[model samples]
Target: MTTAPAGPDPTMQAIGQAIAEGRAGDTTSARQKLLSLWSVIGATGDPLHRCSLAHWLADLYDDPAQALAWDVRALDAADAVTDQRVQEHHAGLHIAGFYPSLHLNLADNYRRLGSFEAATEHINAARTHAPSLPQDSYGDLLRGAIQEVAEAIALRDRSRRASAPGSTA
Candidate 1:
């Protein structure tokens, strides 16, 4: 039920700076800044803000389990976004366009956690939605990343089965 601010929030600018810091290898500073912003944004803030914050926060965690929790929060927040809100927050971007990347992140997190079943489920979801993404360089990059993750999961599953007890290979 939370509504987005009428205009861009200054805090979002700080969050962007934090993201830049993270990209520049200052993850510790980035995380600290993001944590501070999260405190201001609160748990019940605008869905777009929550989704973006949670998605970025997930990358700051080294543990896949913790990252998965943040990814889940991001997805849940994304689900709450209305079309009107999407127009307000992201202009041309639709909520549906976010799903493929979210699923890919979830799949990667699940794979790192050794939950192959969950990983495959999200990987399939990512593939299902990949075509709906904008046909641009970013979309192409995401598609390639999705394929790479899928291959990694397949390789991991194969190794897992080969090492399992009573394997007939």
Candidate 2:
């Protein structure tokens, strides 16, 4: 007999799914649902709840500047989740596990707003944290994402330099 892998809190799972739905193009409904969940989770909720809600909520905004604000909140919430509390809320979760993705999102948001320096800073942080992730598919995916973002940043830099005055292709 096969056992299903344990998941996060039911509320968190639902919120995550709603965020995925938003990512998959149901922004209007997903935003409403996420806002509702955020209300239930509250500001002083469990650290895990706050982290998950804020992380997912970051993506709901059309404006990268607004999204970056939510990303900062998510990172703060993740940092607030101590090891003891992590074990209590979800055995598999660790603050280290959240860093790469959080940094990646921050990098993307910064890049979107044309803040290349800040974006590169977060990308470097993400790369530093990448190896600490579990040696699993998700970890691999995050690493891939980090590489992709790095390449994109490099390409953007090249393009910018190429277009600068007195610059040769």
Candidate 3:
């Protein structure tokens, strides 16, 4: 099978830059940049770009509702992402590897919103997809997060975890 050119994607670089801006505490400009990119990318644009952008965009907001909207967009775009598309980014990457994090984020948002049932559903989904993760620190992190969110779901904890992905605490 022929491999795609190994050049970095400019769109992804832009998204990464925006994410860095947010992490650097310039969330407003980061959000603006991501939204502007979203406007250009549109809903039907590159699923990988949409998924990555929406996933990071969700982190820019502290509000569960707002974050939930972006998380949902990320999940939807993830569904459209093909394994080939993911492999194009990196040879070892797979679309299935994206689900655990995507679902975990959704579960966390739903839990914070006090939607216990929905949170439970997504946490379960995350668990089911956990096996797709590589046996590395990243995989361990997601597995640990899955357990943490599942515990919170069972406890009916509506409060945000200090360790939650988007938490500044």
Candidate 4:
């Protein structure tokens, strides 16, 4: 006899259904519902629930850093259950989503803070994670542009540092 996979908590199941529908174009109340369910999934240490929640949050929210943070937690829970699916999801988010997002956010924040060197570093980091595309795809071109911007900022910072009022150049 085949046994059914144990289902998640009723509340979590409800949140999961909502998140799925939200992804299909229903966000009016989806965000609030997911937020409310986050703590519950987190507390239960349920990898499936946590992974589902993280993916939903990432899509509904534009904050990569926050999404990455959630993904990290989800990964931890997944690890506890020895779940390969959860590991794959976590890796995909990092390799395809969070890394680039964090790179962009870091670059923007550094530029705004007048930390040109820091900005350049983030840009390079982002490039490292960027996906390869057609021989000359738009994403490749964009990544190249970001790299150039970072390099220019790094050079400016270096020049400023060298010219600063200090005993050593």
Candidate 5:
């Protein structure tokens, strides 16, 4: 007989619910809830919470600069996260697998802000971490998006990609 792993984290579940609200087009509620959570978490909170919150918060902003701010915060927090911490919420998850998407988002935001040099650096970082991504739909999506952002950076295009998150109002 084996013991079951711990149940869902209520805080993470709340974050997921807010993220779902955003996905459902009720972004105001999502942003507000996340903001409320942020107040509780403070700046030096759990690395996972900081990383997750900042990443999702970045997606709520239409302005590239604003989005870039949140993305930077996410990346900063990501640096402090441990694989063990990630496994607490997701048994199969590893911190390494998170880098590709995190870097890709930063690259996209920098690209949109006309910071090609910064964007190129982050895109390269994303590609460097790409191998860590699982060979699944999520991996495919990030890989494809990385290519798209890289091409835009090469062309010096400042317009947002239609498929990019935070493109809508």
Candidate 6:
């Protein structure tokens, strides 16, 4: 196998800069820089940096599919490098998904792909990973979301059943 180049990765730094700039004009450059960083970080001898870069790359990508793929990679990298902080944060983030979080992202992806079953599965997965399950407003909100997904799946199933031949109403 061909050996990867050894050095400090300027590409990741460039990606961080471009991302911070937040100019629509810099999106293309930012994406390219992030991709390049992802390629070299694996060989650069730092799993934390690799996981951080992967997380940033996933956040930088606007497309849901692309984001999902990158986030999955970030999670893998975090696990590979044994980032306990990332692991703990990941568990919380998946549940407290109030904003730009992974749980919402994965749920939206499954929804877009028309996999309500998978969407519900992810919602439950998020709940399981939740750091706290206290009976508070936040917990209620989480429960509501899970219930909504469940109801939606039930509705979808009922509709499908109705459309089947000789189905009783």
**TM-score of every prediction relative to native:** 0.84, 0.78, 0.93, 0.41, 0.95, 0.51
Tell me how far the alpha carbon of residue 73 in candidate 4 is from the true structure, in angstroms, after superposition.
2.0
lDDT of each: 0.78, 0.75, 0.90, 0.52, 0.89, 0.50
Across 1-169, the per-residue lDDT of candidate 6 in tens digits comes to: 1233333455445655856643445556666776766666664546556655665665555555666686666555545554343334333232123322335335544654567777666656655644444466755655565555445554553222111111121
Q: Score residue 74 of candidate 6 by CA lDDT.
A: 56
What order do candidates take by lDDT, descending?
A: 3, 5, 1, 2, 4, 6
The C-alpha stretches of model 2 lying farther than 4 A from their native spots are: 1-10, 157-169
Residue 97, model 3, lDDT: 91
Candidate order, TM-score descending:
5, 3, 1, 2, 6, 4
- lDDT, candidate 1, at 64: 73
lDDT for model 6, please: 0.50
What residue runs in model 3 are displaced by over 4 Å at the alpha carbon?
1-5, 167-169
**Worst 10-residue lDDT window, candidate 4:** 160-169
Tens digit of per-residue lDDT, candidate 5, span 9-110: 777888889999998998888989989998998889998998999999899888999889989989999999998888887776889988998999999999
**Candidate 5 segments exceeding 4 Å error:** 1-6
Cα deviation of 88 in candidate 2 (Å)?
2.6
Query: Model 6 reaches what TM-score against the true structure?
Result: 0.51
Candidate 3: residue 158 lDDT (0-100): 89
Off by over 4 Å in 1: 1-7, 157-169
| Cα lDDT, model 6, residue 36 | 69
lDDT of 2 by residue, 50-169 (tens): 887788877777677877887898998888888666665566566787899999888877776778888899999999999778887878877887887777676654222221111011
Q: How accurate locally is residue 65 in candidate 3, as Cα lDDT from 0 to 100?
A: 98
Worst 10 residues of 6 by lDDT: 160-169
Better of 1 and 6 by lDDT: 1
